[model samples]
Target: MDLPPLVEPAATLTDAELRRYARHLTVPEIGCTGQLRLKNARMLCVGAGGLGSPALLYLAAAGVGTLGIADDDVVDSSNLQRQVIHGEAALGTPKTRSAAARIADLNPLVRVVEHRERLTAATAQEVLAGYDLVLDGTDNFGTRYLVSDACELAGVPHVWGSILRFDGQYSVFWGAHGPTYRDLYPVPPAPGTVPNCAEAGVLGVLPGLLGTAMAVEAVKLITGVGTTMLGRVATYDALSARWWEISLVPTPGRPAVTELGVGQDEDPGCAVPCPSSAEDAPTVTAPQLAELLAARERGQTDFELLDVREPYEARLAAIPGARLVPLAQLESGEALAGLDPHRRTVLHCKVGARSERALRLLRAHGHADVAHLEGGILAWIAQVNPAQRPY
Candidate 1:
């Protein structure tokens, strides 16, 4: 399809902007005109965590005029590795506030607006309306769809990104130029089916790589120079140090521009966890787990409680009837096929980390009834069955 005419370029940057962005203005692809556009552009990044960290830093450094942050999470010790925007002093502080303080320090010229509340359906459109573009750095499905739908309604292009372990995905969605996120993932998957970074684990540098790519996309979109990944989705494999691109086309019969509205039916890809897969895995929680164990003891529920923890940890204490299937061995492939997807399955590790990782992998592989013991067996021991031993 033929592309639409590009917007007129913004006027040249000021002397101060030139010096602040000398490195960027020096680049032929992004000269004074681009710097001016960057200075005038307003961007809202949904999450101030991993993906938001680098994305916000680059946008601020590039002189995005107004930056809006929407996040309710506090900066935790665990987030330091990937969320570069937050520092030791900011730990325990709200993520949005922490990020805003950092942005203020990075460039006083860039105005920073902070939304210390979580982004939800009711407030999404209101918060996103004034922005020129939105960068979705959220880790959960609910917020991803919320941001995508709001962007589609506001007609603001969204730079989307996600990372897991060694892999990352980035895409540009919605504009007078191309398709929205609904075109890709029209629905959200079952809750908890998709494990988060805390559960699945991500390489410390992975989000930085993806977030920088998002920053680059935002710059290109705002400047109208070089290639914009409007309809193309880029995938990165950090372990292999390789990148792949796939083109996305608008779904036939999907609404054009005006008919678009925020509705559950609009996002089909939302039905499944992002990084869509052919696999079908189910996830369970701690309460449900204790109930399951109780039912099994009473011969009411018949299923498998596969202990995906290591052998050394298992020696510490194991749940009755829980079979050990150390996570490392499951990576080998054969050990994984031993379980029955059609039956109820519960996975657990020491503190629920590896079990959650196994849950995502199992979901990717087509198992639908798998769940990790909430807080793992540790919680099981603390709450449900006090008689049960935990390590």
Candidate 2:
């Protein structure tokens, strides 16, 4: 099909912009007219992690007029491997601030807004408004629904993408154009059943492939020069290096409109409030955990500390008297059935993220009294035994 002639005005590229965007303008599909639309477009990227890393970099380079980054995390040393937006020097800094600094250095033409907090029902509409587009690069369902609902209410288009291991999924939802996220993912996966990037793991370069596709969709939306990914979802398998597309249509009962916020739970998929809750929703904190372990040491309790780190990590150092259960094998129904749900139990992994997931999984299978060691075994090493080393 012949594409529409992007009617947007030609942007006045400055000497720096002209130099930076000369390549884009030279393309017949983009040229000067498309460049102008890009210059005037505003976009919000949720999460400054794996996907956000490349999405922000490309948006900055594409000269999107304004970019908003929202994240409530800090830069950890481990994040540098895939969260390319941050560097070694930025360790321990707020993610939004770190991403903003990097965007500024990459392209001064793009104005950057930073929100150093998680997106919630209260703040989702407020933060998502005033932007022409939204990008979903978050690693969990809670934030994804928050962004999709906010964008649907605000009448803004969103490009959604997710990466895990060798696989990734992308979709475009513009309620005005077609189905919203609610129409597509009508229900979240049972809470802890789907492990996030932190637990399941993602290849560092995976985001670059998916995020760049998002940037492409955003550019298409602004310039009106080509087919938008709206109503379509894209999936990529890195190992096979192949791409597939899926079509999404609005559910019959839902109507299309431009509102600023949807009532919570009005949509079936948005019913779950938090990502960690679906599987029995068990949780435990540091102080509570400390007391339990102490009781075990004193022979006051009969519970075991289940360490879920991989054998390699467990071999480096492990909690005294703790049993090892590699995280990958955690999905087996019988892997942890040996534990007595009647007794208080503490589950841990290398970092707390995996253990938290494990705790939820245990809770799913009638293990009602399970508790995850907050911050995982790493926290134990820090607070309980400083001299103990970890892999």
Candidate 3:
């Protein structure tokens, strides 16, 4: 869509700003006028993680003037695989601070604002206000809807990008001008229906491809030199190396988003199932599972160790005696064919989330004695068997 420029040109570019953006000046599409617009734009990026890493770096290098980073997480060793904005030395440091430090080195002229807090109903609106545009790089459905609603209420254009494993998707949403995230996802997916990057690992370079595209969308929106992805969703598959597009339109007579969380059902972040205190919802630690397995082997006890993960994961690594019954079969009741409700059973998956879901399913089916492995196979590998490889 050929939308008007989101930002007006700055009064005058400093000598340093002009020299810094000299290459952009050479482009016929993004000349001095477009460069000035970019300098005056205020862009807020939610979740300084995978998708945020490359977007922030490129936006800073393009001199977006002011970039607001909102994230409550810190850098971990796992994030190093894709979050290029943070280095090895930044481990344990807040992501907002780490990203700001990196941006300072990339473009000292651009101002970086660190929100340093999670975006909840109380804070989303306040954080989104005054920004020319917001880039939604959030991971969970909870924060994704929050950013969309907040941006809609504030009437700021939003560029949303998502990456998972070998696939990626991105689009632009502005309720006032076009379809919104709500239009794309009218209702939140059921908890545990979709897995996160941690549960289903991603290629490290995938985010860089999608994140850079997100940055391009932001720049186009700011400068108004190119058509924006306002009403279209672009998808990429790394394995096939193909790009596809899907058109989107606002639902007819969809109620106005007069309130925050209008499209949100619940805030189940990544569908993580934390330990519960209820009597029926029992959980066992990795060490405890190990001991239980040992005691069962010694004929001291009897229990079924059910691996709720997929078959391919079992091929990679699995507990020695666990039986593979994928979570889907359990959820669909197909696993009931050979089921023994009388037998004590323990369930586990890549992480504890799906196993907990499976446990709940069995509990609903009158399984009197059932528990899920806390922290799942990863924890077991860390505690019971360090030799087992992790995906």
Candidate 4:
């Protein structure tokens, strides 16, 4: 269904804007009035990577009046393959700054706001409150849920997109008008069940394709030009060159989001328990784990090194002596029989979130000697083995 335009038309477009957006003004669906609406729209893009890269550039080119970019990460050489907004000169530069510079170069008329900070549960509402619309291109489940909940609470529409390997999915979630992200994914998939783009790898051009689609939806929403993706999800498979749409309905009996940060208990995406305060579960820093491993190798002490990440992740990089027992197998009790109760066990995952969950699960099942590696393999790469490439 077509909704009213998200923003009212501005008084008029400048001569340069009229010429710059001549193609847009030529269209009956998005003529001078719609171009003015685009000029009046304020959009907040959650990440300046991958999907956000293409989406931000296109939105700026489309003449969005104000674009807010929220991202705390810096550009690395690894990001160049997909995050086209940043270049070789941007290496070690903050993603927000890189994206802002690119956007300014693309269209000086569009104002770019840089939010070089991570969006946390505490900051989500405040950060999201000022925008008319949000584009969520965050990679993790926890951030995705946070973005969705914050948008729902703020009554802002969220245009979301995800790309993995060769597949992509994009949708719009507006709690006031239709289904939300939770309506589509009530519970997050089990940790480690889904490999992120970093872990699984993504085609270089995949984000460009999907992120461009997200930009289209945002333009449609702003101008009320065509049917928006409010109640539907579109999936694209690059391998097969196929496109499919699925109708989404609000889940019956789903609790309404009345406040921010109220659903953590029910959200499986909140994988990491507060480390300092979590009872019974202890954490080992990367250095401590290294020392322990050295001691075990020297026969001075003994403990089990359990890697709770997926098989493919282990293949990417792994600790020397850690046994690969993917989190799913441990959660299902299939890997429990192999664990020996006599030895102390240390768990690790990509970072620390999934391993923390594994620690809690082990304790729940009466294994009292398990502790998780504080920062997981990434920490090890950072502190112990600088040669190991981290995902």
Candidate 5:
């Protein structure tokens, strides 16, 4: 659908800007009028991670007048593979600062606003209200929902993108005009079921593929020059070298969002607990678990200790004596047959999330006594085995 230019064209473009955007001016669809609109547009990017990296670069080069970068995290060494906006020198710098510095060098005509704090339920609306549109490159579900809801309330259009190991998805979401993100994903996936990039990993160029697409969508939305991806969700499978798109429409009779915090609770990736799930299974602190190990060693107690992380993660580091049982095996049900439900059992994973999932699975199978190690093996390593290396 073609949206009437969301931003009004500026009174005039400087000679430098016109020269810099000379190529855009030649494109019939995005000539001087579209270029002017882009120069007047203000966009807020919700993250400075993989997707944000490319989107920011392209948007700035395209002559967007103002770009707001909102990110509280710092550039990590691991982020270099796909977060191209930052370099090795920016390792300890805040992502917002690193990205802004890069954008400045890319196009000094583009004004950069650094939003150093993470957007919370309290600040999303106020910050988003200032922008004409939002580019949501956030990773976790909690931030995604917050961006969508905040955009809905602020009456701003957002271009959203997601990238995993070999797949990427990008779409434009506007609550007032077409389907919002809630229309695309009505319910958040259960926590721990979907792994983050840190755990699952991703192809180095997947974000680049989708992030540039996100920038194109933003350009379309800003100038109304081409049919925007307002109601269409597109997917790219890099492994197959395939691209596919599916139409998305608002859920009929779905109640309009009246507030934030819609799906925020479903993301266990965040520090907060998942309010949607009641999986408050028993847990033991690392110190308490150490005591249990000693008692078992002294022949005073007996229990089954299970590790539910992936095989690769086990190769990195693992607790001694804990039998390996990846979460996938437990979910498949065959692994349960080997375990005696009557025996006391304990579960642990990389962090507390996966082990919490395993504990729920064990309980569902009639395990009489089961508990998960609190904070998973990382906590155990910190409290019990400081010499152990972390992944």
Candidate 6:
């Protein structure tokens, strides 16, 4: 919806600011008046990874006067594929700092605020306060909920995006003006039910496409130049090269979000099953697993090496002799009917998280002889086979 501009125009633009945004000023839709509104806008971005990378760069280049970056993660080699804001030399550097340096080079007139901490329910409102709008590129559901609730309570409009493998989706949520994130997904998905980018992987250029769309939404919201995606969701399928839209309305009987509580149920890092005792939940190291596999081959032992990762991941790289059973099927009990109850089972995924969930499911269904690989297939690649590539 095109409402009044979110930000009032600054008193006047400096000669350099005028030249820097001349391209924007040339557009009748975003002339000097709109550029000045962008200059007065303050936006907080909840992540400095993936979607945040292009969003931050474009927002800075567009002259959003004040930008706040909230993230506690550092740059890793793996992130360079899509996080374009950070370079090779920035490995191990905090993402907030790395992004700020790049933004300063792109547009010195833009002020970047570094929030070197995670946005929890305790800190969400305080961190989000005074911002004209929020752009959330966070991955985990916990952080997504926190950002949504904080924006709702503060009555701020937020642009949100999610990318997984070949699929991408984005929308705007303004609780006071229209539907919120909870309207699209009323309750958080069960832990381990959804795989993140690390588990599912993504097209390298997909984030740039979706993140730039998010930046456009922010600019439109700030200038009131176009109809914002306040009540509709836009989806993209990279593999098919198709774009679609879905209408969303506030769900009837949905409870109002009056207070924010930081729940651990959706925290990605804490998704592993809680053990009754240390011994009850046993783990096998990569070397131990290799030895056990060798014993099974020699008919000295009997066990099933269950791979709980998606089939695509297995096609990329899989441990020899491991059977494929995607985590979703395992979680839903559909894959259990085919398992051999007599054989001891050792489960694993890309890392240990998904397999731990599968282990818990098996144990809950009366399969007693079960354990997960400690560090999962990644560890096996490092310890058992140096030749294998780590995804």
The candidate scoring highest on lDDT is 6
Better of 1 and 4 by lDDT: 4
For candidate 4, lDDT tens digit of each residue in 54-97? 99999999999999999999998889999999999998899999
**Per-prediction TM-score, please?**
0.72, 0.83, 0.80, 0.82, 0.85, 0.80
Quantify all predictions' global Cα lDDT against the true fold. 0.78, 0.77, 0.88, 0.88, 0.88, 0.89
Shift of residue 356 alpha carbon in model 3, Å? 4.1
In candidate 6, which residue ranges exceed 4 Å CA deviation? 264-340, 351-353, 356-367, 373-391
> In model 1, where is the ten-residue run with the lowest total lDDT?
265-274
Q: What would the per-residue lDDT of candidate 1 be over residues 1-391, giving only the tens digit for each residue?
A: 2322223445766678778889987899777777777777888998999999999998998888889998888887778988999999998789988898898999989999998877666677778877888999988776777777677778788899999999999999984567777788776664445667765679998999999999988888888777778889999999889999899977878755442234443223232234432233334666777678789999997988899876776786677789999888777786877877788778887666577778887767778877777667777777767776443
| Of 2 and 4, the candidate ranking higher by lDDT | 4
Summarize candidate 3's per-residue lDDT along 203-316 as a digit string, tens digits: 999999999999999999999878899999999999999999999999898876665642233564322122333355578999999899999999999999999998988998
Model 5 regions lying over 4 Å from their true place: 261-275, 285-305, 311-325, 328-343, 364-366, 374-391
Q: Name the TM-score of candidate 1.
A: 0.72
- Model 2 is weakest, by summed lDDT over 10 consecutive residues, at 262-271
Model 5 agreement with the true structure over 1-391: per-residue lDDT tens digits: 8889998998898899879999999999999999999999999999999999999999999999999999999898779999999999898899999999999999999999999988877777878877999999988877887788888888899899998999999999999999998899876676666777876789999999899999999999899878999999999999999999999999999888787652354542232234454455788998999999899999999998999998988998898889999989999997999999999999998877788888888888899699989878989999999898766
lDDT of residue 232 for candidate 1:
92
How many backbone collisions does model 6 have?
0
- Identify the superior model by TM-score, candidate 1 or candidate 3: 3
The 10-residue segment of model 4 with minimum total lDDT is 268-277
C-alpha lDDT (0 to 100) for residue 203 of candidate 2 = 94
Report the lDDT tens digits of candidate 2 across residue range 207-288: 8888888888777777876787777788899999898887888899875433334344332223244334424445555556
Better of 4 and 6 by TM-score: 4
